[model samples]
Target: MSNFSNVSRRRFVKLAAASSGAVLLKGCLGNPPDTTATTAATVGSAALPAANVGTGETPEVTTIKLGFIPIVESAPLVIAKEKGFFDRYGMTGVEVSKQANWASARDNVVIGSAGGGIDGGQWQMPMPHLITEGIITNGNKVPMYVLAQLNTQGNGIAISGMNRQKGMGLKINDPEYVKGFERNQGRKFKAAHTFPNVNQDFWIRYWFASSGVDPDSDIDLLAVPPAETVQGMRTGTMDAFSTGDPWPYRIVADDIGFMSILTHQMWKFHPEEYLALRADWVDQNPKATKALLKAVMEAQQWCDDPANRQELVQICSGRNYFNVPSEVLTAPYEGKYALGDGKPEVNDFKAGPLYWKDDIGSVSYPYKSHDLWFLTETMRWNFHNGAIQDFDMARNLIDRVNREDLWLEAAKEAGFAAADIPTSTSRGIETFFDGVTFDPENPEAYLASLKIKRA
Candidate 1:
């Protein structure tokens, strides 16, 4: 029997009610002044479900172990837990564990919590592809499926104080910027990102290459955790870095660096983070999986609401979560951002997470084209040496069975109409910051156009 089979509905409901009251009371006390294990236990209990809200159907697995890194992009998972969305969907035993980095998160999913690993959680857009390609899992491919996109347009690249002082403003792909970097630093400008072969690497490399700077030769890139990005700048360990919030906002707020550019500025409405799960778990727990998706979709909608921004920030700032100031968390959501180079604050779209959208042809839907782009990038960086010559063969590596169909079912259950559902799974041609357009059908042409690539 699975571990979840032992939990009785009545017993779970009684515990959930008590825990919910404790969570409310704890919130009333300004996010629990006590950080004791007991307080954490109370909060954990509150996160469980009070009743089986499913359609007279029990989940194959009642407990879910979700993994996440402490960043603003992981807000959907956090919000879902805090608002009791998981419990409302009958997933009463959901635990959101904090991962140290992306690599660890990937490993957790590959090795599951029972074998001392995570079941699923918030991950980078390219992670599922990388896993499917057997790059991160030691040649043992773990079938991971993307349930929904967590957010878009929340990531940014920032330059150090030294670089900013040398007239190296937010100019992309400029010879002067490169010269300024070399002149100011007297060496290749050192940069850092959360992980290799991920969105941070892709954006920074794209930005640099677009400006005629060879990321491989012109600059030195390092892997630094998002939490330590600002410190790396202050200590002169790195000249610049690309990552998601609230580190970028924190850099500006701390006066250590200036925002060079946001990811949205490069490719508007680009997919960032995603909620991924192990494919086997998803297959075995169809009802539970649908419930999980429904709860997260609801949370995504809630997070995007303007009125809930402040409360969302407050909730995300807790010691158990992002552990940053509320102001840092608020800037990206409210569209009020400080450039940190003594410039006027700009009110960019700040376009929060697109959970479900009709105008964008299913913004939350995982387009095969998006995965193809990520796969091409992985090959570009020499992370995977698959046959890129055959587009169909390469595209077949992505888990198509669980991609858009699951999200569509969840959306329908969430009260979306047929008109809101996209007719096609592909988002069609996507253009980037450098005026280069990527047609999903012709990814090879797109890959061939890039001047700076290793594949």
Candidate 2:
């Protein structure tokens, strides 16, 4: 059994209903947020069948242990519990646990969390090809798949305001200056990232690459966990780092590092953290798995409503979960940055997290080749040996982890009609925020287009 407690639905509804901020979430978020989005998203179908609401008699895991950190991206899991979405979908036995770090989150999933993490993202990267290649040699090798991209906004790059003033990547978009950034500095220009493979590393590398800095060669990077990022920024141990939520704002709150680049800058609505589960769990308890997905999806819709965000921030700030101050959690969500040096920037997005769209969230989960970009970085970062490896296995690993079919099923079960989500498996060009598109099927050309070499 997991150690965390379950949140009751009535309590969940009351909590959300009590908030005026949540009421303004819906339409307010749809337009690029001028001020914080101000419209509670509409519950598209009040006619949703309560019969479908309750989980049918299916074998359940009884206790599911999922992992996450204190960042805003993990709000859906927190809200799902608070909103009673978990119990509604037959995940009554579900319990949410906050791990100390991303590695702990990964370990919880790998070790099965009876003692530690059993299933979910633990502050780690995509393991490069781990999900796509199914490389679980250490423990029970369950094919791992994640459904639904939680945060497109959370993971981002920041630099000491000193460096921020220098316009590190943007001004130095020249490849040569990127390569010369560290040498240009009298001392090493240290950078920050959360865990190994996830957004911190990817965003850091992508940002570095954009500036022509070889993340591998140009600067020293410290893989500090999320909480430590701000302190590192404060102490000058790091010049900059890529991380999600709270930290950027925390550093900004304290006025240290300011937001430099974000995932949206890399690729619009790009996937950062995700809701992942072992492939074995899905195979054994399809009903329960689908129910879990449905519950979280519904919760995500609820949170995407701009109105619910303030309360969600408060909930996420509680001692039980993220345990951070509400100020830290809410800072990034509002697109406000408080660089310790006393500069602030308000970030706005046309597409933000969604309650429902043409049926995508502002932070909707879509599998794009941009996700696959991590694989080459895996090699570049020296995580994966330069194995041209088998693309078939690669595709399978991605398929196993993405579990798009399961995500769609959950959406349908949540009352979306079948056609509401893509049913066809055919992969195609994924449109990005920059209007640049990536086709998952044609990966090599994409890799070749970037002049950077494998690490």
| Model 1: per-residue Cα lDDT over 1-455, one tens digit each | 11111222233334333333221111111121222222222221332112223245566777989999988778878888888777766788999999988888888888987898998888886778667657777888888888787777688789888766544444453556663566765777888888987888988888887777788777888888765767878877678888777877778878788888777678878878788898888988988888888777667656655666788899999989988778887778777667776666768544433443423655556665677777777777666454334555556665342366676655554444344445555678999867988887777788899888887
Error of 2 at 303 (Å): 0.5
The TM-score of predicted model 2 comes to: 0.79
lDDT measured at residue 201 in model 2 versus the true structure, 0 to 100: 76
Candidate 2 local lDDT, 1-455, one digit each (tens): 11111222232233323321221121212212222223334544322222244224454565577777766777778877776777655577787877777656655666575555566643344642364353423433446766666655555667775655454433243455445555776666777776655567776766666555777677787788655666666776667777666666666666675666555545655556667777676677887887777666667656655556788778889999888878776656665554433334545532233323322333444353334555545544556454425444445445445555566555544444333344233324555433434455665555555656574
lDDT (0 to 1) per candidate: 0.70, 0.56
Question: Whole-model lDDT, candidate 1?
Answer: 0.70
